[model samples]
Target: MKPLLVVFVFLFLWDPVLAEMHKKCYKNGICRLECYESEMLVAYCMFQLECCVKGNPAP
Candidate 1:
């Protein structure tokens, strides 16, 4: 029971870390898309590519 509780607590704490990592990647992709003005299409394409690579379907 003690080991199970420890595992549960570890997993609970770990989830937010994983979520933040994904959020950072997604935000970086958005920032990249926003940074350039003339090559908007290219920037958007790159962002989409990054999202695909990261397995984030709704970014």
Candidate 2:
């Protein structure tokens, strides 16, 4: 029972969003976990992620 309670507490405290919080990009943009369709990648955000910025999206 104690182990189960510990596991639950750990799970509750662990958050993916908190781990991948928004980081500042180099240019006028934001480092994101995932880039939007209208946003263009400008630089590296972190491992597997890149910096993103609002640009004239391709047609």
Candidate 3:
């Protein structure tokens, strides 16, 4: 019973916003105001931001 209680407490303390600044973008890229010339937009982020990844240089 004590082990089960500890597991439950650990689960309850887990936070979704621990990395709120770049929640959507992980090792792939980052969240920014806009994707620039050398970056590509992969997804949308909170507060009108964008998840961008490095891309090939523009010709």
Using TM-score as the measure, name the better of candidate 1 and candidate 2: 2
Q: Give the candidate order by descending TM-score.
A: 2, 3, 1
For model 2, residues 1-59, the per-residue Cα lDDT tens digits are 99999999888865653454475667878867778888887778555667788985565
Task: Give one digit per residue, the lDDT tens place, for model 3 in 3-34.
Answer: 99999887776453235445657447788777
Best-to-worst order by lDDT is: 2, 3, 1
Worst 10 residues of 3 by lDDT: 13-22
Q: Compared to the true structure, candidate 3 yields what TM-score? A: 0.50
Task: Give the per-residue lDDT of model 1 (tens digit) for 1-59.
Answer: 99999999999987765554344343344322233333222223322322212222333
Q: Which 10 successive residues of model 1 have the least lDDT summed? A: 46-55
Clashing residue pairs in all predictions, respectively, total 0, 0, 0
lDDT of 1 at 43: 25
